[model samples]
Target: MRRSPFTTLGGSGFDGSQDAEARLRWFEHVMRRDMDAPVRRLSRMVSGEVEDVIACDVVNPDHIDVEFDSIGGLESIKQALYELVILPMRRPELFSHGKLLGPQKGVLLYGPPGTGKTMLAKAIAKESGAVFINVRISNLMSKWFGDAQKLVAAVFSLAHKLQPAIIFIDEVDSFLGQRKTSDHEALTNMKTEFMALWDGFTTDQNARVMVLAATNRPSELDEAILRRLPQAFEIGFPDRKERAEILKVILSGEKVEDNIDYDRIASLCDGYTGSDLFELCKKAAYFPIRDLLNDEKSGKPSKEPRPLSESDLEKVIATSKKTQVAANEYNSLRSQLVGLSRQTETDDYPVQAAISELSKLVVSQILNLQAENQDS
Candidate 1:
């Protein structure tokens, strides 16, 4: 057997040993790169999944107890929560002695996007005087099977340690899905782990922890999980009134036009969701500011601050209503408006009243009514 020399290179040239080592290093690097492919893919999928903490956590327990004056909508859900869930928690001894089934371990918030589901969850946390653990499903999910479950368990365990806490999971349907029972081993495992975590949380007398899962997709959740959840907070899209309130809340600080009528805007935005309302307000605020900035450069008084003109708002509201209206509503309205031609012949009225209350009808409807008068 020949003994190999362990020698250092006198120059940059590679000896057999050096070449072999280099090749080995390259092979190792290649293996590492190949093995890392799946991990990289998973990391990409899991990236940017943590939710920002709101002002309602264990650190600020009093915040939840104090009334949140900002959430103008969700009155029904809030009342239901206050009557059924919150009041019970206030009198724990009534349940600690096993009077009631203990406070609900979970509250699910389900609704369309932009209806302030997350905000409602925050308000609940603030009201409940509990520690708030805001979790994003992406933050827990991992390439390694069971890793997601472990994170979930850890969250519950920590929440339990800090009792009277609420775990708010946003977009929870991404993971806590309806069990398909085939091919999706990862999803199944996650659901099982979540359920186990939930059981552990509720089983304890000291576990004053409340689990809150929010999703736009309520129907997509597992029926079993839904069954277990004590209460489901139905966070529907903001109605016209709620949307108007949200708009007011957002636009409170901005300079609005005197001609801009909030009632009219609300009427026009009847079908707009809260999110759509938020965007509309943002645009309303931004356009004025941008226009003002341009006007300033030209030595003008920002065109009287362009107070959210009625036309500007109406156009925005009309665009939003077109999209926000339910398909059924849009179809129904479209049928009535089709082939409608208007002749706003005031003479047809014989004598004009101060104003026609029903002039608020769509132009198409007005034209149809006017045409009827002409024929008569």
Candidate 2:
């Protein structure tokens, strides 16, 4: 006869009370041997579920094709990120002295649209060799109630598992904006949960996780969110020199004439953003192709199109207008704000009202410019 596996538990055969007792003993023995099996299985199930939900958002540093060198201008911003984010993450031992010296839990990158804020975040991910979780608002939302909160929790849990991770939220103002009473319950709960997890990470001195957010309208963010992001950098428009450098970088890979005056092109691009410069270059590049097509259509034997010339860039510049907030107008408004503050101290000229009026005017002008750009 075949022997039963439970025979080791003092079982002789399937007979009577002794056999029942032996079975009981065998059950207890098995439980003792694998007591933690269920717990381990539960933990793995939860982890696998979280991974399934957010696996698409996780990005390895090696896959991020951006580098700090590829980004033009913003040298100061790059240096700041290198020191504050990359260095600490790369050499945590150097920053393990105290809570104050530990890596920042949250960093905000605020600027106008197309100022390379997102690009900078990617460069940081690439340079720091940290896992980048590109958190989108859609990823957290769920049709089922209470799931949003769980998803939010999952984000932090995943980030914790993948230590030395950067959770990058582009246009974060839309995600964690100033909370209103009319806000959806799910959204409010998700935001609360997100902030709570963000604060929780700070208690662990060794955790290299960081929340990196970018927005054009920082003022729209909730006060609590801003408080968590103590380290904020303003990525404003590039200056004339920076614009020239940007043009050079954009055209570096293009077939362009050596005599193309980048300085003049930059000057013409006055209030243009980095994105605007790239579009300008893109439009100019087509000129050569257009000429080649014309030559072919006319039955003229053309070996190849001529290299992009200064006149080609000039033509594009003449037609293209700056789509960003006018630098001069922005500077003027800033000066007025400063002057208003000074006047508040010296002369009581209804400073608050004047400041409010100036703020409104700035907003209206920006809106009008946006509308004009969209229309064009």
Candidate 3:
């Protein structure tokens, strides 16, 4: 009796009896043009004949050299991540010794654009001393059905192999949107598979892989995904003091005139985020260089590079606008979240607290309605 081609390769294209070294040789021969084909093939085999969708890149611990102290402001956010992620990874023996003080399974950083969400993840990865896996939504999407699901499984398996790893999913809202009945079959399957893999990370005590995600629109995330990420922190706009601190930090290494006023510049950047502040500094730095270049072109270059002055910053500030969106829309969404939190009985306190801080007015309204309903 003749065996099918699929049966000969142990459900893969290669035969199981072949040695690992021999399999590698054959893979290398056929995949000269495409480097990822062999890896994908191997992933399919490791995933038990599941489709291959592994597009994410794994970053070694040495590459992530950013420390928590380097990130200015948001000290509270840094402290929480240290306790939740870095502490657990560094001292797993403390977590696994029958104590309920296990590390958090997943953490979410959410807020408006340019609030340093990705920066926080990098800092955590550096602090944790664990392998970092950076995954984007584009890496998860696939034209093939069931491919994304298998890829999700493969990613978790890779994380497990490299135990004590951090998987940072940037722009998580796009990949794990609110599940709907009318969703595409492939999308639904991918979501289900991703969540299942996430659950596995939580249950496996020895598997020290933490999922850290950042999103500008946390409200767009699915309820199921929110439950998975029990620890959530909002990276909102920096207060006036924080803005001044941020400006000082940004200008620390730059050549600035003695008369430049940080407090005044901070006041000018009313609604600016950490990123916006950085941009403002860059714009100010270029002004002097730009003037020098123009002078040189006209055969009137100065003796030396002039230091950035308050006039230059003021010019930039006059032309530059803050990127803050209208707050009323987010205020209403925040109220809805607080109301949902009240009904939730699970141990998702961090998520609830972050949502509650969005707006106190919404919280009061919801509480009054609940009280009136009970009285009636």
Candidate 4:
């Protein structure tokens, strides 16, 4: 008595009359029925209105190439992520005993720019084996009045359907900044709806969805948003040893001279971020090529560029100057953070810790600047 799936497509299926898109949709609908329960659940969760938008942000674990080991430093942060986020999703049974042991609903990774926050998020997506929703502000915004809220609602709904999902938002402070009276009503509603859904997911102990956000400006986040993100990790700049390690990672597999002293390079490139170090390496690598081009321009015989040497790196480092934070700029940021820390009513441990770290970094930079000035 059962009818064929092809028959349900109306008329003769695969007759070439239907458009390619329509036929593909029909085929997908038919194939989804036989998929595993989780896939079926995910399919059912995406409503027609938000399906296209949500689908664009869904990142498959296999496609993500980043891994924890690939990141040069931040061992502590990696371990914390494993304990708080990865372990729970990988083995839920261990956390099922009580609500206290359950994974955090939201986590915030905050620190200076170029501190590998985005890289860490990618590593989590790859290592956790969870569905990663790389949310972007553009993806949630809509020109229509009510559509924006619906998009925000759909994000959580889709995330719930895909349990063990990580909804990562890079530069989260921009999207969920401090609520202000001058803000547009639509933007305000979107933030409120986002928080409502976030809280809703927290009540479901069995739900494995997590909101993983990274921000350079933690103080700009709203109070309620901060409350939701209880587990905050500061991805500060790498120390001397870490900088050496980062250098090794950056120069790995490259043609380099045996006399290249990474320790000397690390010591010389003080206060350079991982990104800045990478840029330094890139410029050093170009030294050999620049020579080769010069040789070609003249009547000299063409030859392969020599391997990168310590002098090459040192030359680039000598020319490259790290941008120092201006006194006024530093003071403005420090005052804002000092004000934020003075709020005695709220438990602002994260903000306080960030301020402490910022002070150390600034002091170090000032000393380095003074030393450079004396040398000059």
Candidate 5:
């Protein structure tokens, strides 16, 4: 007969004591493989090659030199950010060392695309003098089974080491989507690990690590993730007055005609986002250059190009279009945010009033713009 591997060292036969030892050994082996292996992987990831990982992901403050004033429009959002992020960072002594008042651990910036979400995040880091880590979700994805989770853990660990860091995840919905059974196991595990690390931020009163995320589709994010981000703000389309300010800011550096009719341009671009406005200005300015190039091609080149004219802008406006956000889609996003604001209410971030005011403003502005477009 073939003998089993389990054999008593003290005697010839395998007995109950030997069987118990063998069972204990097998249990330890399983635990190490299933439990301890993950811990070791996490440890190694956190401790080893951290600098290299951070170098790839972390954006230095010098690289993000945009000041708060540089971002035109959204004055109320800026003030809210001052109270939520900048104030605490400015007076870190008051927030550190087990004080009752603590800085917000995370903030979420959500709104329509091209409204300067990334710029706003950079401005906060610039204002606070914090290291900004731009975390790309695609970079964290791994082909191996559990490597992505390990990478997520490693990111938090690196942030802890580099204190006073702002980890900005632009378009965060793709990274922390609503959890479901059909979701890939790797992605789900990565999100869980990221959340666990985020929860730890509360335990450290002076960690100086804030998570800032921006997304156009806030409803697609996981509820657990939203709960962690206590501070939230909506960066909506600039109103007509704000649009004029943005126009002046964009044209401030350019040599343009004295009578450019900025207010008229702003009114005409009622639905345009800040980015749309910039592109419009560029195209309008190009009309003068195009004229100069045509003159040169006809062998009647003028040495000096004419200043940008109202007629040039008007011509562009005639053909140019505003990036109108869909009425139902904008309303749906606003409603979702209003509901989420109510559901995730906490003392640290009382965003209900802000959300209510923003919702009303967004609805009014978008409706007015839509009415204008329809009338025209």
Candidate 6:
């Protein structure tokens, strides 16, 4: 008589070794068959699913309008995204000499934390009216090995179906980083397979998929993945002028004193990332409100809502500036990028290098800028 599955899986009957062997084999099969299959494709039908369902939570599809809320300080990136990708995408007929529209050259956005990389992406999608799919690795990354790559492939397949789609993969270095194909190598192979699929999508004429990846740790990404993305932009921290603009946006409609020196406030926030600026501004706004409320007693105060004083605002700006660590850390990041940026092979190398060098100089000049801000 043949042994039943009960006996095969039973620890007592198999002496543990046999059961272990069976379990390992079963795991291998499950991982190979199910995990390696297209998880993304199984859900979507002949039509397509909703794009916003996968978009980043912070980025809303409805707010895809320029409400004077433009991204601060990265004019060049904005222009490039518009000129190279947006215009071409909108009017493919102009570039009919077979030069190919944006869907071909994927974009890479790299910079320090809180530097508006994600914001910039949303702005692009808004400006272009493109379907934005925010690819989250953690969401697709299954407990079973090699599942994530299948999901990635499915995402591209979906992107093809949804033409003029912007696939924004944030912190992309995690999946496309240097492959570790040694012992725990399943994920590496999966990523490679996904990459191949991404490459294959280049040919699908109907697939107007524009890939945008962002990472703070650009050095960690594999060269193969980097090369695939020809249009790369660095989303560095806001400079003095940008910090001021960012503050203006964040502090909008707030009761800032008329005499409150915004130029000084912007100058002092040297090295602050875009997120940092927001944080600083938020902090500045919060304290005054708190004070106004706390000062109120049983009797109504002289002012129903206390008008924020210049001194109050100055104090807030000073405290907020102290909180920003980006100014101090910018130089180190700049050094590391300059070293790696040399590998970026393109005809615009000289221009890019010059711009990068100038940006680095600006970082140091921030203190002087800050000083002038103080004197003003």
Enumerate residue pairs that collide in model 3.
9-14
Among these predictions, the greatest lDDT belongs to 4
Model 1, 288: alpha-carbon shift in Å?
2.7
- Model 3, 1-376: lDDT tens digits are 4222111133334554555666555545434533342233333344333222232265545555467766778988788778878888999887886547877888999999898888888888878877677775566677877678767887788777655778788999988999889999988998999898889777877668888899999999999999999999999999888888888877877788988788887888888899888988887898888888888999994767789999988887776656663244445666677677788776687866765675566655765575466435
TM-score of 1: 0.63
TM-score of each: 0.63, 0.74, 0.71, 0.76, 0.72, 0.67
Question: In angstroms, what RMSD does candidate 5 have relative to the true structure?
Answer: 17.8
Instruction: State, as a TM-score between 0 and 1, how close model 3 is to the true structure.
Output: 0.71
Q: In angstroms, give how far residue 293 of model 1 lies from its true place.
A: 3.8
lDDT of 6 by residue, 228-298 (tens): 88888888777788887877676667766667666687787677777776766665566666766777754
Clashing residue pairs in candidate 2 are none
Q: How close is candidate 5 to the true structure, as a TM-score?
A: 0.72
Identify the superior model by lDDT, candidate 3 or candidate 5. 5
Relative to the unseen true structure, what is the C-alpha lDDT of residue 364 in candidate 2, on a scale of 0 to 100?
63
Q: Please, what is the whole-model Cα lDDT of each candidate in the order they appear?
A: 0.60, 0.78, 0.73, 0.79, 0.74, 0.63
Segments in model 1 whose C-alpha atoms lie over 4 Å from true places: 1-68, 88-95, 257-260, 301-311, 318-376
lDDT, ranked from best to worst: 4, 2, 5, 3, 6, 1
lDDT of model 6 at position 161? 54
Model 1 is weakest, by summed lDDT over 10 consecutive residues, at 47-56
- RMSD in order of candidates: 18.0, 15.9, 14.4, 11.4, 17.8, 14.7
**Residue 350 deviation, candidate 1, in Å?**
70
Clashing pairs in 4: none
